[model samples]
Target: MIEVVSLIDAAPPRVFDLELDMDVHAGSLPGSQETATTSTGRRQLALGDEVTFHARHLGLNWQMTSRISAYEPPYHFVDEQVRGPFRALRHEHHFEDLGDGGTRMTDRMSIHAPLGPLGAMVTRLLLAPYLSRLLRQRAIHIKRLAENVDRRR
Candidate 1:
């Protein structure tokens, strides 16, 4: 189980707006590259939307497809693995209105390793710490972008 919580200095709608644009959100993350909409357009990120991602992590290339299982405007969204390296992967994202022009965002995820006991051992020894740092860095980047960078046109 992996959980992370972050507060952004923007309203729920603003934070949600950033998330709704999959391409932009994905590009903002460090080491993430070459994001594009699949043959599936408009249906790209709504509930039931299926998106494919190709990324490199730890010097290894990874390709995976994720489906949006839950979506509620300005509130929450969830994506689960339709196909990925993990035996199981589920990520939930939540947004709460902070009233003072801010949004509190939370991410909860559970990932089951692939190689049974060996996978669990590797996760406990290496993967967890690395993933935690990556997630925290992403949160910090989002906060800076949401609070200081204005994307409204």
Candidate 2:
């Protein structure tokens, strides 16, 4: 399993609001370039809602569909892999109100490599560290966006 965590300064509601907007949130990722190929039907995300991600990872084109397994407004949301390269993936998005008009946002993800031990070995040797750096960069970008965007408040 591989894990990454980040804290963002923003109100919980604001953070949740931004996260529910899949397109907007995906666009904020550092190395991710995502476009909505299919409509989710509703404007706001809810449990069971399906979102598609067309992304370029490590210069490879990839398509993934994620299903919302849990959703709690102003608190957290969880998305599970419906289809992707990973054998298993569970991503949790959480927000804690700092009480001073700021929120602490966290993202925790656990992934199992698709190729079993061999994949795990490869990830440990190559992907894990790179992914950590990527996630950190993404966190910084998110923090800057949330702080600078007028609508975030």
Which is the leading candidate under TM-score?
1
Clashes of each: 0, 1
Local distance difference test, per candidate? 0.77, 0.73
| Residue pairs that clash (backbone atoms under 3 angstroms), model 2 | 10-103
Q: Give the TM-score of candidate 2.
A: 0.83
- Write one digit per residue (lDDT tens) for candidate 2, span 5-78: 55666667866887777556576664667654434666467788887778787888878778889988879899
Q: How far is candidate 2 from the true structure (C-alpha RMSD, Å)?
A: 2.6
Q: Which stretches of candidate 1 lie over 4 Å from their true place?
A: 34-36, 42-44, 149-153
Candidate with best lDDT? 1
Minimum summed lDDT over a 10-residue window in model 1 is located at 35-44
Which runs in model 2 stand beyond 4 Å of their true positions? 1-7, 149-153
